[model samples]
Target chain A: MSEKYCIGADVGGTTIKLAVISTEGEIVKKWEIPTDTSERGKHITRDINITIDNTLEELNLHKSSILGIGAGAPGFVDSSTGYINEAINIGWKHFDFGVELKQLTGLNVWVDNDANLAALGENWLGAGRGVKNLIAVTLGTGVGGGIIANGEILNGANGTAGEIGHVTVKTTGGAPCNCGRSGCLETETSATAIVRKAKEAIVKEPHSALSSIKEITAKDVFVTAKQGDIAAQQILSDVTETLGLALANLTVAVNPNKIVLGGGVSQAGDQLLQPLKDAYSKHCLPRAAEACVFELAELGNDAGVIGGASLVKQYSNEQ
Target chain B: MSEKYCIGADVGGTTIKLAVISTEGEIVKKWEIPTDTSERGKHITRDINITIDNTLEELNLHKSSILGIGAGAPGFVDSSTGYINEAINIGWKHFDFGVELKQLTGLNVWVDNDANLAALGENWLGAGRGVKNLIAVTLGTGVGGGIIANGEILNGANGTAGEIGHVTVKTTGGAPCNCGRSGCLETETSATAIVRKAKEAIVKEPHSALSSIKEITAKDVFVTAKQGDIAAQQILSDVTETLGLALANLTVAVNPNKIVLGGGVSQAGDQLLQPLKDAYSKHCLPRAAEACVFELAELGNDAGVIGGASLVKQYSNEQ
Candidate 1:
């Protein structure tokens, strides 16, 4: 008997990462291709099909050897119906990615919000492996979250259960968000916000090393703050405090056993986690604060791919 | 075969309501007793036992007909361990209400948060009936919440899943809350907050009729506002807006099929709901907002008792 395999794909704005994993979660082959999501929905679908076909061929596996295919995309998805309701960045609306992909490759296809897939991946084999209840927050260009309860993803009534970034953390409506909402958690703590706020601060404190840079990023702020740049440090502190406030609110509301932090900003590690933990404990209800455990995500960038692979297993079980 | 019955109790800070319910969801008989939770642990047990005995006697039923009993209390409860972790108002900590009640009455007992029980009751027989995914918010002295997903109460890993009152809607930390947190949803929209904010406004706007009142309550604020008191109306608008913001956050995060509003403040009806719906729609992602439906709770005060009675049936099926 030969090993069974499934194809996992993570489609992003600029590129698509594809991986073939064995039944035991081992990646047998991996590849990537530039995604032309801007051209048309058909072009994007064709690109995905080519990647899957090439990956399987390189691994000496036929299309028949694949069990199913799972893909994670950024947008509102009807996982049950396999429809992409709307993906603003990709310029797609109500696109049946699953049906089109299945017809293109003659394979079963499953699609969901990328953050949820990442959470599933982490829960199955990463930081949240042993936890029965967990919430994963990703701090990239924008903040995103996925919730797992009793070992299952909570998709809620409309497959939007874990849209945590849109949660309001500010009453003053301090910042504008792309989601057309004011004072969202994402507006305060996302990497984009951190960089934006840092650049704005540099104008006032021209003595800071950050002022020398043409453009500042969250990474620049982290490095400059570590070197004792007061402006950089202040911005970092603000970001962490904002994140902590959101964490406290989430801690009280969800009361998950573990909270796993992921995405680029999370790479700052303890610089982000320590202050966040302090603020979370200070603001949360005593019992809930005591019951929660916070940790850095272990899966790193590969979480999305691994999570996409895990979706095949999850969907199979559901069926 | 003999008819099966269960005893359901709703233990509030001021009163304990008890009912003998048949398996078919009928309240055969019910009674109420003053709760002396002031004395803490032992007194609560004695009071609960006496209430159960009296209710059973009034219904002309014997202990042999009782299948089990369930109680809902205002506190952080460890439903699995049958412990009331904390009841701030009652000063009860780490009290095993279920164990004591079972020992005294010789019946299997289950215990949980009162608000959660109310949600369960609503799901079983009230406005939320037939909806597998729903959240119920009760706006009384303090705001409370219950979450039901796929027909089961969402008691998070630590048995604190549905504490929606603590979800921060305001980033500025508007007012201090009883839970030692700031800017909690309860601090702005609860019945207590409605009255407190109204009294402050009445003092400033001395020309208003509300200024002549010796004391203001949530009911008084709603009534005075309806009668065209500027101070009262302003407070009502603030309360409705705050509640709407909280509901918008919840709707985005959970994407429940329906949100049922209950408790004293909800009695303001469309005066509160229309503004809340507008704010919620404005804040939520279009997809999630479109999928959600808001309604007033149908169970009223007896929702707790009915929900507590249904717990036996709910858990029995789980086992």
Candidate 2:
């Protein structure tokens, strides 16, 4: 009971999720606040500090009770130095993010990329809980991934170790991606990619249910495919195959214990997972395929905060 | 002089390279013996044991003067158990390799995939030395890669970590690889792939210099390209671009401090490296690219033995 807690903050473009987490990896309390976009994100840290202070006072906790603060931000973060190179939505560039937060709250601060933290969070307490090595793929607007090896986040030399979305599935020809690459896995597997594929498929097969939807969504594609729409089914099949090839290729390189699929598109569950696994098995080396299991990410939106807490916990242990 | 030494062995399809390596990683003495295939690889460990004993006796050293034996073999190796799932060249399937060696020599034996050890060797003392993380790619008959993270080999769930050649680069149509996949990085980057590309180009452009050579080799392609052969140059360009994209994709996943290019094709020197780097820079996220350097593998053929010795050194430290 006398043990200390740390604050886990997941900073997104629109909102910041925060949690009071026990050193033992449990979330004690959680809340969120709108991100302060005014002044180009200069007030964001100050707002975070105010929230932390108010929360401590409300819980009748002493300053000493909080060990540190860990924040997961959407950018290239130098985790060792807590520097964020760039985050367009939050308007941060070349900012010493950790220092600003520490200056406001007088508490230790740690920062890492949001996706990397999500991987860590999933490895720590989600579906990949017991696995020492895993790759967590988030399939939303963009395909994002985090790699965990030896139960630690793999931040590579430039803290971009787990950019799975950028793994090129097709080199000669495919859709262009935001990452300035063509044929990236993200261009095929992201929610955006799914909707695009559905829209394209509707044009090719006008009689398909997807043609009726004016604004085709990722969910609409999956739901239509489930209803036996040939166009939707074909789109899902193509995306799943792309996802499989990406995962299989990653498996060949890293050979993790598990591949955890997350993000908005992943909620399609068995419909998405079964085909992906089958394709992975087909593409992967038999030995690597036999041992690795593919599973849905369990943490969902909470991965960032939990992963932030895990980062703080790791740093505390190191200290 | 009183310090002990360990034996390092690199088992291959034709011959087994062996070295009496100092605990500090220097090759004290080295030699090789033809791989015994008559008894279905039953005598491999025995030959290794005899070689070690004879060398120790010739040096007037006692058994206590040696630490242990480390061996690197081609296959899916269970480093923890020293069991090889399959090594086609050695005819080993579900073989308990370490136990057989240990029973003969009464010394601890450690075995891992040959490429993985080569990566360890390079990471420990070759071009990747002083770097904590690296991915060593060998562009030989088939592309082989080893991933080193936190100064140790990353053995994935099935001990198949660092299998970079299998990374799929083309999804729709490409050359079929031996690993039951089409459009693998190996299909473009391997020395075999390079020769194949050149030969196909020669057939298409019959007047090109490549048509004169009866047995078009990878070195021939590089040399002819260097001599202003446009056909050969074009082939190299295509291959390097493919290599660059593949390496760039991998860099996005692991972000190692160094990417060490090894094997026969890498000997092409700047002709291979410069274009590869350019392609990598083009495909990679700028942040990851900034922190990673590409270098040629310095160890060459010696990498296997050295890496085996490194494994034993690592085990000794762990003990």
Candidate 3:
């Protein structure tokens, strides 16, 4: 018999990444397609189905061999029902994502928050592999988080569990966040926030290495800090300290075995992890800190799609 | 076969509250025994067993009529193993509670953090009854938190899943907590903290009604505040605001449907809940705040023992 397969779709603002994974959790084929936001992302499900059909045919596989599809979207997703309350980045709102995708693909489809899928993907084969309790933090334009407790995604009431970005880090005099709160963890640790802090620092230290860059990025700040620029080092310290404190507090609450750092800012690697660990140790309940380890996400951009596959494989096996 | 019953023991610093609960969730008998902390609490298990034996014989019940024992302990208890790493209040450290109790009673045993059990108890029959996702916060000598996700206790990797007391509310210049951290939620929101704040306020407002008292307690602060004492009112506002913010941050991470307020400090009822709810709504992510409600814990001191019974009933059904 041909090996059973599943499709994983990661719907993003600009593009949608899809993968065909074997039942054994290996990616057999992977590709991407442009996300058409016209008409409020209504075409997204149909487009994904078309691409899956084309990809399956290209692999010379029959539709019967496919187990199901798992989708991850950037929005408040009621994963139990595959309904997305809103995906502002994709211009979609109150859409029945899972049902529409299932109708188009003629297979069972599971949907989850993109960050949650990334955490699951990482747990399946990435940094948090085999760990029942984990916290996944993605440091991109904004900080995103997904928590896995007892080996399942913590989809709280209304499915907003693991909204770590919005956790207030600063009780007073904190920078404002897009979530209508001030001093969220995201405000101090997101890539954008890091760059903003660096830009502000450069204005004060015009002779610093960061001042030479046309537009200072979070990466540039890391590189400059590595070169021993005091200003850049201070910025790095501030971001990591804030992040570490937040993660430490979160650890006290969830007590995860591992914390996987992902996305663009985490690419700074140990530059971000070392100081962050120091601050976390200083702030965390010692026992929790000792039991939890920090690791950089191994899957990179494929985490969401891989997590999607994990979602499909998990639910498919249950049936 | 006779109706099965389970023993629930809430091991506190001074007393061990035990109950015989039917498999169907009814309390058949309830009582308490002073905790003998001699020999570093080693006598606790034996004492609990002897009382259970006495109770069963008095009720003319056979051993076959019993299911198992569920115990709740203070401090860092590894729920999965029933090992009390340290219950400082009770003089216990590195004690294998579950195994010892099981050996003595010859019945299955489960153990968890006292706060977590209170949450289970609340979810089972109190304010959070039937709520699959809930957060139970006990405001007492110290703050205690328990999170229930999808109807199960969220015992994290090391059993600190609901250590909401350690969650940092003041990131800087905050009072120190016993857990070797500064600005922990416990530092600002505990019963002790309330009394401490009230004492400090009364120092300046010596003409206030609170100044007339020989000793001030958390309850006194609430009552005085209700009677329009400026010093007490300020103290209540400060404590509730800090508590509300910590709870709001916790809610962002767990997103429980109901937040149950328990312990002695919560006895203030609306005086605590109203201002706390207002502060929570002001700080929590709007959607999460909108979805969640605050309720007073109904079982009072009985919550922990009731929660223990719930634990036995849950695991018995699973088997």
Give the number of the best model, judged by lDDT.
3
lDDT (10s digit) by residue, model 3, range B1-319: 5689988899998999999998778889999999999989889899999999999999888988888888999989998888989999888889998999999989889999899999999998899999988999999999999999878899888888889898877778888899887888888999989888877777788888898877789999899999998889998898889889888888888888999999999888998999999989888888788889999999999999999999999987878
DockQ of 1: 0.55
Candidate 2: share of reference interface contacts reproduced? 0.77
Name every residue pair that clashes in candidate 3: none
Tens digit of per-residue lDDT, candidate 1, span B207-228: 9888777767888888888899
lDDT of each residue in A274-297, candidate 1, tens digit only: 888987776676767788898889
lDDT values for all models: 0.82, 0.86, 0.90
Candidate 2: stretches off by over 4 Å: A170-176, A199-208, B1-4, B60-65, B172-176
RMSD of each: 2.9, 2.3, 1.6
Q: List the residue pairs that clash in candidate 2.
A: none
Candidate 1: stretches off by over 4 Å: A1-6, A46-67, A103-106, A170-175, B1-6, B20-24, B33-67, B88-91, B103-107, B169-174
Deviation in Å, model 3, residue B136 alpha carbon: 0.5
- Model 3 chain A lDDT-worst window of ten: A166-175
Clash count of each predicted structure: 2, 0, 0
The model with the greater lDDT, 1 or 2, is: 2
